[model samples]
Target: MFKAKNVIRIGKGANAVLARPLSGIPLAIWAFSLTFALALGSTAAQQTPPPNPHSPPPTSVTHQMYLDMKLGTLNIHGDNAVVEALVLQRDIPITYDYVATLMRTPNAFGEGPACIVCHSSNDQLKSYRGLNLSSCEGILLGATEAPANPIVIKGEPFQSHLIQRIRNNRMPLGTPFFAPVDTDSILAVKDWINAGALNDENFTTKVLPLFVDPVAFGSETACTECHKSFRDPPSFNEVNLTSYDAIMTGAFSKTRKKQNLPGLPIVVPSNAEASPLYQRLTTSRMPPGTDPGSPADHPNTLLLMRWIEQGASCD
Candidate 1:
């Protein structure tokens, strides 16, 4: 526990200056100073409650979702290919430990490496989202936002939100645009869930760094600055520009309804003019609060447009 101290002593001179009219300072500067002070004061006045250690971690499969991606795509990688191939050929069931090992290993396709980022007990998002994916049991608990549907529904992969979200590239929240879970990986999850998402797997944990696709990811990962993911009711949550795949996945738009058509493509390979991503940035409809088509954003936009013009290769 800590105690507050009166650190500032206002002398008569300082008081006199504050009490005096704003004749000396410019109106713009004065107004800016006042606004800054009020904002700071308001921030200081509000207090965030301390994290409760007793609060159990969220039990959603959000983190396990990443693990599922890793485990599901074992056939594509070199080392795991032997065992996975054998398992597939013999029609032998994939075991929990084998899947766990695959999860611990880094995926070649870059779905993700681990579940600790947002699912750990100490993770802030766990508390906010009421979902934890730190363990097999935790993942089975489902997201707080959608408790009715288990994140992984044993024997029914299609009914599982975990599969649906990953298939749609909506889970893992803030991944890069070109990094959707590949078809093979999605199928792996589907198979695993159908086999029952078991927890008996013994995994020797090792650190596998996340895979970054330089061509597609570039520098942007955060998109909430220009887009929203959470809606008032969780169901209304829309797709964000988190990755190249996400961009390609396309989002539902207000215009889609008015025009009575399906959503528009954000990126159309070899067609920058047709790309909503290029047009929106160039036309200045995004970065919501910025000057429309601000020059500051044009260079990146141009590079992206050119990439699209070159057929938007994922490689």
Candidate 2:
């Protein structure tokens, strides 16, 4: 009736005893006992239950998962130390859905909704400020026509512009609206920055254009035709295309009224195949006044496809 622990201890002791030979009779008896004990110990250990190696360690609990809703892929990873803190301190799984919820209803400082919600040139929050959180390339790589500089995301908080603003408390100011941000949100951002602001397990564009050059697409004009006058408010389609902010927010026709299709938005960047704008340009369905042209005959169609393939980012 030996318990699991006792069985193991007895097995070890039998081995030690059997290592040295005593009187013939004692040694023979000891050998038999040792064999039986070893077998029992092994059986008990096997039935005791195997450790869950895949389970994150108790102290480590930084969990992250990326969902490219359009791509239909789920990328997941975890750091037990960080995950534990996220669970115990933040009480949330670091998943795309979770992050999206945070972004939609961000804290005072506007931290959440993932990077695309803020860095994108077509973000809904463009009207509030000229900030685009869709892609880091335009803002961080200076790929946009405006020529923004690279945004470093490493080292001390002072080194990074994003961190500096957060640390200096210059962000989440109450000019247009005022709301308090949570300490945990700020810490999470700091932790992300400290970790080199990695895009691993996150949806990212494979290639980013140097600039949103309409000329490259054989268009002599910018997106001013239908997007101008956004600098003021209530721009065409309730969108502003004057700056990165406006463009991101205005690019897509959210309401069904403005949408080309009966029940679909004009632009669904995530689903290029389903977007009416892309279908119109890439296919033979030109607008009312434009000359009827085939999708293959239109160079702009290729450009639009390339843009969509590049995540349709305004950055």
Candidate 3:
């Protein structure tokens, strides 16, 4: 398991300044007699570099100083001007490996893909309360502050919406999402949530591997082999799902024209329902052949549906 270290804070002070290696030397040389003479001369001349000649004179000394500082004064303020720097170090948890292992095994629920059983369009479209497993990041992040309602993030395993849904008898009730998630997985998710659900490099690298199929299925192979021509745009109306990037970007469309739908967008992050490819697969209307059967008749189609529902990802 990966562990993160505490944040390091460096406070600003004279010591901090002195610790920094000095750069170029100042042009002016100060001596006791020279400084005394210069001070006396300045007082007699009533001249103090014309209070920064480049800057506009202030209406008053205090106001002038304030405006000059605001306008980019070279002078630094007192101790209050000190800056504090903080560095955070994070580690990716090994729970992602466990998730990958679980995904590879047959779902106990006798579903297509164990991962998809809990994640795809079918789950999200349900009328009752349930966690949308489409995007792990989305579920972890929860909703942003909006006008109508604010989504909350659960810092602990028991408090998380995903955890609560899994525990509930209503959801994944008969599904794998309801399946027993290991304590390590729960803790990993909890740690991620507590850490602000950041999509940092480490988190992404770990999470992505869990979402991709360990073994390539027939549909992925068949689609890649048989559908070479449709891979590019203008030939198949500019909708290409030949690659993961294309799928996430919503490059596939049967109508050859783009249309807007409610819920999640196909190309937008966490917008699986709005994705046309998912819609076609879940609806059992894909392969674009002359005769397409119901979704129930196609196992490959089912797999694709499950993959999408589980969070369509390249990893």
What TM-score, computed on C-alpha atoms, does each candidate reach? 0.27, 0.21, 0.19
**Candidate 2 least-lDDT 10 residues:** 202-211
Off by over 4 Å in 1: 1-84, 101-113, 121-128, 146-148, 170-315
lDDT, residue 19, candidate 1: 17
Lowest lDDT sum, 10 consecutive residues, model 1, at: 202-211
* Stretches > 4 Å off in candidate 2: 1-101, 108-130, 135-147, 152-158, 170-315
Candidate 1 residue-wise lDDT, 229-280, digit = tens:
3221221234444443444446564445458865445556545433443333
Off-target runs (Cα >4 Å) in candidate 3 are 1-222, 226-235, 242-245, 252-265, 286-290, 293-315
lDDT of 1: 0.34
For residues 124-212, write the lDDT of model 2, one tens digit per residue: 34521344443334344422323243333322222333322222221211111122222333333334334443343321221012012
The superposed Cα distance between candidate 2 and the true structure at residue 51, in angstroms, equals 16
Among these predictions, the greatest lDDT belongs to 1
Clashes of each: 13, 22, 8
Model 2, CA-based lDDT: 0.31
Model 3: lDDT to the true structure = 0.30
Top candidate on TM-score is: 1
